[model samples]
Target: MTKRQRFLQRTRSRLFSKGAPDYILLALVVILVLFGLVMVYDASVIVASETYGDQFRFLKLQTVWVLVGAAAFAFTYLFDYHNYPKLIVPAIVTTIVLLVLVVFAGPLVFGSRRWFSIGVVNIQPSELAKLTFTVYLACWLAKQKQRSGNLKEAFTQHLKTELLPFAFILFTICFLIIVEPDLGTTAVVAFTALAVYFISGTDALHTLGSFFIIAVMGVLGVLAAIISPYRASRVSTFLETIKSGYAPDPWISGYQINQVLIAIGSGGLFGIGFGESRQKFFYLVGNSAFTDTIFAVYAEEFGFVGDVVLVLAFLMFVSRGLRIARNAHDRLGSLLATGITVWIGLQAFLNIAANIALGPLTGIPLPFFSYGGSSMVVVLAGVGILLNVSKSSEKAVFR
Candidate 1:
């Protein structure tokens, strides 16, 4: 039979197979995207008005991206996710080209050359890099596993073949991002790659050895940052404030964090009311309210109750994502789900914690809620993949 006939046969078998529908996860994704839209509008109004001379500018752009992202989500849902393996090489090549292009062709933003400006909007290649790398690695590793039967075959050659290439890719990407000076994103991608490596079951010893190398690389990364006067100053400022009781100057390194604190603290038990944020009035400034410190803007406008509801929504997403991973039909599917869950969940935790002063200001946005096209698009696409996996699950896909 031709490939098209085989595809039709498989599709019919899958459609008539004994498995639950995947609407539940799809619905949850829609809910999160909608929630993000509401929060983005609330957080970005002032920034947009001040920066772009229109209150609805950021909101309009975000709406467009969300719409495009949702369409991508639906496209993936209708397509077979197992076919991801077929697209891996092209995706990786595309990602690498973008990454390289960003270095030479992209415009600088916030002292980092991370975005590729296309007329009206800016696209961050690093965001797409995460999903692309995850899918490629998972696909490659799974095939390696299938070829390895006994422990000895797996140990002697399979692990080396599978892991070394991943390590090289991770290091190269990490180096480029660090050069871009997007420390937070580089860290996230590096760690996510490590998670995939660990899940691939590439020998405990190899995994542990990789951990050691990564730790050394991390230390060197810190040294590199220290060598840069500006970065060194930030680190010093971060440490100095810890040692001295003197309040941090709002004009310096502490400015962003202070604004974040004021926004959250001013809200108290009840928020300042919708669109009544005092901080947004030449206080928070620029895209701060929309991206890195969105939770602060949210807290200021929605109060404690709103915060709780948002957290609950995230908790629900996490639970459902984990469920999808657990019931995945195969190891590749399981690893893909788990990696995405960790990426979104950990990033969310980091963003929330940074806003509340639980950690240093990492300049990373809350996933789904932040005002960025690449993140919204790629994250939704990931959710689409998760839904595809859910569709293939033995349990009810709709439930």
Candidate 2:
């Protein structure tokens, strides 16, 4: 059969053979959101109170985002995800336009122009771009894999067919984000897209070559960081603290992380006990701190046990997502699952890693916990599509 015929067959089968959504995944999502709500409130108390004079300001906005996200989740979950590829073009174009517009017209915050403040709502285009780009890739790679015909061609002709288009798309998205100078979000997108490509059944040797390419890109990124005084200071602080167990300025350069580490350590084995955290009132006291180091507040309030449970919960979420990808009946579903999973999983890892000093402080928000409307909505929507894939997996697709 031709590729079109195969694609039609899979779509038809999906429409007719739909199964119930995964309740375990659904239940797990609820638990995480509820826990995150509590933590966001906990972390944002001082910041909200001082900045907005209402301790409930961030929490209320986040609640609205969560509700909006739930609507987004419902939309993706109920729709046939097999049809997502059809909308890829307009979706991606819209995202790119938004990204470009945000660069020129969005409100400037800190040093980067990354958000559009429209009336009472603020929109971050990069978050939407990340999602749209993932859907585009899942469709492209799945179609490319279908057309490759054989393993030899899949290897020999892969670069021309796969990497060229993939590279262009990936570079376009990453370039916009990097120009925003938001390396944290850019890293998440690139790593997630690379993971999706690697998981799409490429050759082992080519995967190694891909790794080498990524290494070169990483080196370039480091060089770029070194050239900027602000970024250089962050790197130096990270390195210095790593080596000498101290921050340059406990209230300025590395001060944020210095406070974060203190929060984590003071938590002891059982945390400072819920709403009794001392760090939020003084050091980690700001709206930015919620996104940058909310995990530290979490660690301080919940202690070691809370940390373990949260990490384990995220691990379970990722494993189940990967399992869905492994069992997806079609290439599109499988690739989509992989991409979405990597997107969520990597952000979670980077956020926590930064908090614990396991990685550079990227200021990336934790998936559900951080107080950002754009991210919360986009991420929950991704989870919705992932659950839709899980629903499809139960119909004669098991290993």
Candidate 3:
């Protein structure tokens, strides 16, 4: 067999050593990636043509990223997932430092400095930080799971073992991102951390208390924004648009959300039949066709049916991820698998929700489907790690 075939066979053997992976998850990922490619091309064509004078500009860049991401995924699959826990601290530290560096040394764009230029490609440290935080949290939690007796003991144990370390790391990261002022990414990381805490079997009362505190913090944040002239203006514009019949001006604050809703409405049931989306043709200015608003393009073209299918796909991915967690060979493996799964599912849900106006506009990308270099690469790499975990889970040494 060729090296590639050998690698696949060996990994499959290990993963199925416990039992075969649910094919549904793999199928869903494949389907989403393919659909994303089509929609990305469709949504970004006009923008690409306008900016680069080439209709295929965005498509070509996305294709390159996908190809590179696939290689990353493959490399992760060939390694052992359990080994990652050993490297968690250093990885987290590196990410944390990068987060700090981005604050001082990163380039500022769109009123945020979340990106660090690494040669030709600008890298978002926060994206990698999300995964690093999850891995570190999982390892820390799994270690703590051993010392607890009852719920109270577990709660206290978690507080000392998990929360303290997590707090320092999370605060450092969040502080940097807030300085960059990428509220959306900070929110995503916070949500991902909450998901990990929830799945790690923390006490409900404690978790609820934490949630309440977070909610209060968020409200306070908005209140602080209300006092700042610019942030207050942005908030006021969003509220005004919602309250009034239509936003009178599109050039300012409400433009992106307004245009997204319009694109969704224009698509109807079957979508404007692909590549015919009018909003993408300069109707929407700030929202990138392939990234934050990719779902809008999909909805406009695919309509309700298409939307339903995307939801179903997410459900399948979550189901398989949960299943993998259940069958994980050891505590570390289980935690890693669960953390990764929750991260992906949570992001997917949040992105789709934002697109449909179920929530406020958050600039999060749809996993695998949104046009972004770091997000796509990170997600695929995550999948590879999960696959590796599945491979050795059956024989995992659970201490």
Best by TM-score: 2
- Say which prediction, candidate 1 or candidate 3, comes out ahead on TM-score: 1
Over 4 Å off in model 3, which ranges?
A: 1-22, 118-120, 148-158, 202-209, 212-249, 393-399
TM-score of each: 0.87, 0.89, 0.85
Cα RMSD, each candidate: 6.0, 7.1, 4.6
Ranking by lDDT: 2, 1, 3
lDDT tens digits, residue span 1-399, model 3: 899999999876744455444445666777787778887888888888777798887678778888888898888777776677688889988988888888788886765676777764778888887788888888877776465668877767766776666666666666666666666676777777766766776556457746754774475456436433454554566566667745546766677778888988887777767667777877766437778888888888888787888898888888878777887878877888888898899888888876765555657788988777888888888887777776655533221
* Per-model lDDT: 0.75, 0.81, 0.74
Question: Candidate 3: which pairs clash?
Answer: 14-391, 15-391, 267-300, 271-300, 271-301
Q: Which candidate leads the pack in lDDT?
A: 2
- Ranking, TM-score, top scorer first: 2, 1, 3
TM-score of 3: 0.85
Q: What is the lDDT of residue 360 in candidate 3?
A: 52
- Give the Å shift of residue 98 in candidate 1: 1.2
